[model samples]
Target chain A: MWQEPRYQKETVRENPVEEVKKITFRPATDIYEMPDGFKLLLEMPSVDRETLKVYIKDNQLHIEGEKKKDVSDGKFLLQEIRDVAYERVFELGDDIDADSISARYEQGILEITLKKKEKEPVKEIKIQ
Target chain B: MYRPFPPFGSEFMKEFQQFREQLNELLKNVASGDVHLASDVMYPAVDVIEQDQQYVYVVELPGVKKEDVKLMVKDNSLVLEGERKEPEMGQDVQKIRGEIAYGKFQRTLPLPENADLDKIRAEYKNGVLLVHIDKKEETKPRLIDVQVQ
Candidate 1:
């Protein structure tokens, strides 16, 4: 049996139930293989190139940023989304040369190119 | 001495407890995310479609910059991860209601064998991420001519 509520309620409740947050926001990215290196495209909308931070830590690439927040007075009919902060970590492989990692942000996309690390030569010793 | 049903009853309760434990674990997995993981799924509603000619993915990420998104091919899977945050709500006195999920999210999708990962292209316009995986030219079937007998 289904019972419908009699009236539509618009008043906001003081004690709202806390729902589990879904984990989804890591930026939408694309990886391409070029002749020189692998190109990683990151989509970070509304983030300024200067404000964005990118670094490699513990063999993982971490990206952090924050959206601009406003605190002005305004009448609202309806509000849905909440203020957000961003952080993402990517585990890098041994083949990636940390020293050769280079990143550039353009048009809301962070392009990171990971150059292949050169193999080190092994030396042989002669026993006299 | 009537102890026939006691053994069966104990087993049923044990099974029930195990079921409850599994349910709790599942719930915690959904809720026990860090601040960043929560925002990823809460922000965008995305759709991934694989067709005969191309692999198309559509992501609805409003107010997010293109540079903020990071797509990767790790372990033969395509991972879509990003963050979408809403600006602070102003200083107004009002009763608060239900709030949906927010924070960071990571969605990894497996790629098909025919997906031309080498020639992938993506564009974001009007708060939508459109990614196109072009099929390899050699993989496209060509029509053959047959002489009249």
Candidate 2:
């Protein structure tokens, strides 16, 4: 049976200490099941390699990054992109090999490959 | 004595402020006929900034290649067209969940009359595109000294 990845919702604090609160947005993601394993792609614009982090803990995969603002001194005439952090979590199944997971980030896209564990072969039984 | 609700600097107030700003932007876009509510094509978010000498347009286009993008100047508008192709997968691949938008996108922005289209320059880096349009020489703010009578 194939298990779908679950998303974990984060709770916002009722009272924040900082004057300027940093918002976190969930990046768009795509999950695909391959012959050998699973592939995940996340769109995180303005996120660089230095600010991106991909890790696994307790059978859950976490992808988080902070978008760096390049030009801060200019006055915005039309502002659409918000300065926020990107975060998303997905639960991994038992069929995946946690240790064999690999990730790469390029052009603001993070690609992750999770290998599936090898299954046991069945033995043929002969009856007299 | 009257007190402000959400206590001025509270988290809820800050979030409300952010929401208001976003709503204002959305309303502005709608008024300017820039919002496309019925279109299936993805319109990359943009931020236009005004500087001393030039106007900058920053576009967010994650997962798009530079070769697939096309930029042009038509009349008094800057047109941006690009395609974000889906990532290549194996023949037996099965999509479990897809939230990313992948396809051709087009966004046209009306340029100010003072913008010097001849001096336009663009650069793509880290999935972000930066377009700088220099201001015309005569239109730029100039300092003048008055003769003392």
Candidate 3:
């Protein structure tokens, strides 16, 4: 006897909990290829150094940052800038060495460098 | 191979859709802005506020150096000039996507009579510039005393 599923055999259930994000924005980025490997530049204004994070996992690079709005109480005669979060990710290939990656954030621009691995020796073939 | 980064996750895609809607709103309000069709996205997004004692200006200039920015008052107007130099991209480098605006730009805004341009002060931090200007006492709206002769 099949227990507990005779009438609900094809029923599908989705996760009941999902957190709604308050605000979200995508930061602009520029990718460049260097002699050694690659360079990436991202613009994320007002994000604190401590709030920024960059890490690689499963050969994918992820960059995330958050900017908190000022809590000062004042009448906003003109409102334009607002606090928001930024996220960007990229896939890495084996040609680049992930262990040698380095990054720096300054003036709201994050720069990341990924060094490439040494090329393997080539074997010559002679045609008869 | 160089390629524009795709939406890495569903969260990114959802955010991108919302951002696109907001951009469309901006596009619809073309009359309020000097938006050039050729160059829609520009640098140094600014906000101006008028307070009782002063006027405030906030500008966003990411990746720009302080020395590169120039602020001045000319003909009773506030003038801002700056240049964002492009990072050297070698021949082997291929462009994936470019959204940030670069190169020199100039913006001039007319000031009100109450603005004391000479008393302006500016501070730059976290790639944002905040400018404060004291209000001119003479131009402040006030009631004059009247006496009977």
Top model by lDDT, which number? 2
Sort by DockQ, top down from the best: 2, 3, 1
TM-score of candidate 2 on Cα atoms, chains taken together = 0.76
What overall lDDT goes with each candidate model? 0.55, 0.80, 0.70
Model 2: how far is A90 from its true place, Å?
0.5
RMSD (Å) of each candidate, 1 decimal: 22.0, 10.6, 13.5
TM-score of each: 0.38, 0.76, 0.66
User: Compared with the true structure, what per-residue lDDT tens digits does model 1 show for residues A1-128?
Assistant: 01112211111222122332323334545455444445566655445344478887778777765433221232322232232334456677677777888887654456677776776787778899
Q: What is the interface RMSD of each candidate, in Å?
A: 19.0, 5.8, 7.8
How much is A125 displaced in model 2, in angstroms?
6.3
Give the winner by TM-score. 2
* Descending-TM-score candidate ranking: 2, 3, 1
Model 1: residues with Cα > 4 Å off, grouped in runs: A1-36, A48-50, A70-80, A106-109, A120-128, B1-149
How many angstroms is residue A38 displaced in model 2 relative to the true structure, after the best TM-score fit?
Answer: 0.7
Q: Local error of candidate 3 at A24, Å?
A: 1.7
- Could you give candidate 2's per-residue lDDT for residues A8-96 as a string of tens digits? 23322221433455556667777899889989888788884676898888888888777788677789989998776776777788888
Residue range B1-149, candidate 3, lDDT tens digits? 99877767998889989999988866753322212233434557776777778888777788889999999999998899988887777587876556567888777767778898779999987778788888888745778889879
- Give residue B47's lDDT in candidate 2 (0 to 100): 94
* Model 3 TM-score on chain A: 0.73
